[model samples]
Target: MAWMYLVIGGLMEVLWAIGLKYSDGFSHPLISVLTIIGIVTSFYFFSRALKYLPVGTAYAIFTGLGAAGTAIIGMVYLGESISYIKLFFILLLISSIVGLKLNAKVEA
Candidate 1:
């Protein structure tokens, strides 16, 4: 399903994003290679999902999911801050993505 692909892409986006932090500016060869693989896989799924989903809707959902998921991963795994305001915005992003997905279903 397109939604499944989109979610996988989002997860890969999060993986690469966190991996980037450990890459030491790409000096860490293993982490850098993993990061590159993650990014490529993320785009591959994203592009595949676009074949069935509208570009505007799919892209918005993809980036929103990536941003929110990556932020949560950073907070939990990387011990980044999780302020009330930041939490509120993340929730907003999730809501927006859900709304877009619902809209896309209705459109189809």
Candidate 2:
């Protein structure tokens, strides 16, 4: 359950990140509001996740997900260039996240 919260929180982080780009430095009122909401929700979920998961592991995974998701979204929707090297590093980040999860000592 904590892992779920962490993953969801990470996704929310991605959402807010993209929202920020669209918010035009908060000039777009609605987008800025929604982005703020996403940011709040992301933190809420992170707190919920911290109830069970180790702080370091959880935070690393959370930021990994957010960074990777944001990068992918930028490449796909925001006209960012897609380079093989960039993709390779993204894959490395994903692999590291998975490795951390596998090595985590989950509290029963």
Candidate 3:
């Protein structure tokens, strides 16, 4: 359950990130409002997960998903380049996130 919340938070992080891109430095009213909403919702879920998960583990996973998801979205929808180097690093980030999840032990 905690992991689920964490994952949702991470996805919200991605939405907020993309929202920021469209917000034009907050000059765009609708996008900016949605971005703010995303931010609040993301943090709410993140905090909920933190009640059960280790701070460091949860935070790393949260931000890692956000970073990787944002990059992929940018490439797919925003005309961002997907070079070998970028792909390699994105994979590395994903690998590290997986590694952290595998190593994390939930408190009993």
Per residue, candidate 2 scores C-alpha lDDT tens digits across 9-108 of: 9999999999999999999999999999999999999999998889999999999999999999999988999999999999999999999999987666
Question: What lDDT score goes with residue 50 in model 2?
Answer: 90
Q: Model 3, stretches more than 4 Å misplaced?
A: none
Off by over 4 Å in 2: none
TM-score of each: 0.94, 0.96, 0.96
Candidate 3 differs from the real structure by a C-alpha RMSD in angstroms, to one decimal, of: 0.9
Checking candidate 3 for backbone clashes, the offending pairs are none
Please report, in order, the local distance difference test score of every candidate based on alpha carbons.
0.91, 0.95, 0.96
lDDT of 2 at 61: 97
If candidate 1 were superposed on the true structure by all CA atoms, what would the RMSD be?
1.5
Task: Encode model 1's per-residue lDDT on 47-92: one tens digit a residue.
Answer: 9898888889989999998999999988888889989999999999
RMSD (Å) of each candidate, 1 decimal:
1.5, 0.8, 0.9
Task: List where candidate 1 sits over 4 angstroms from the true fold.
Answer: 105-108
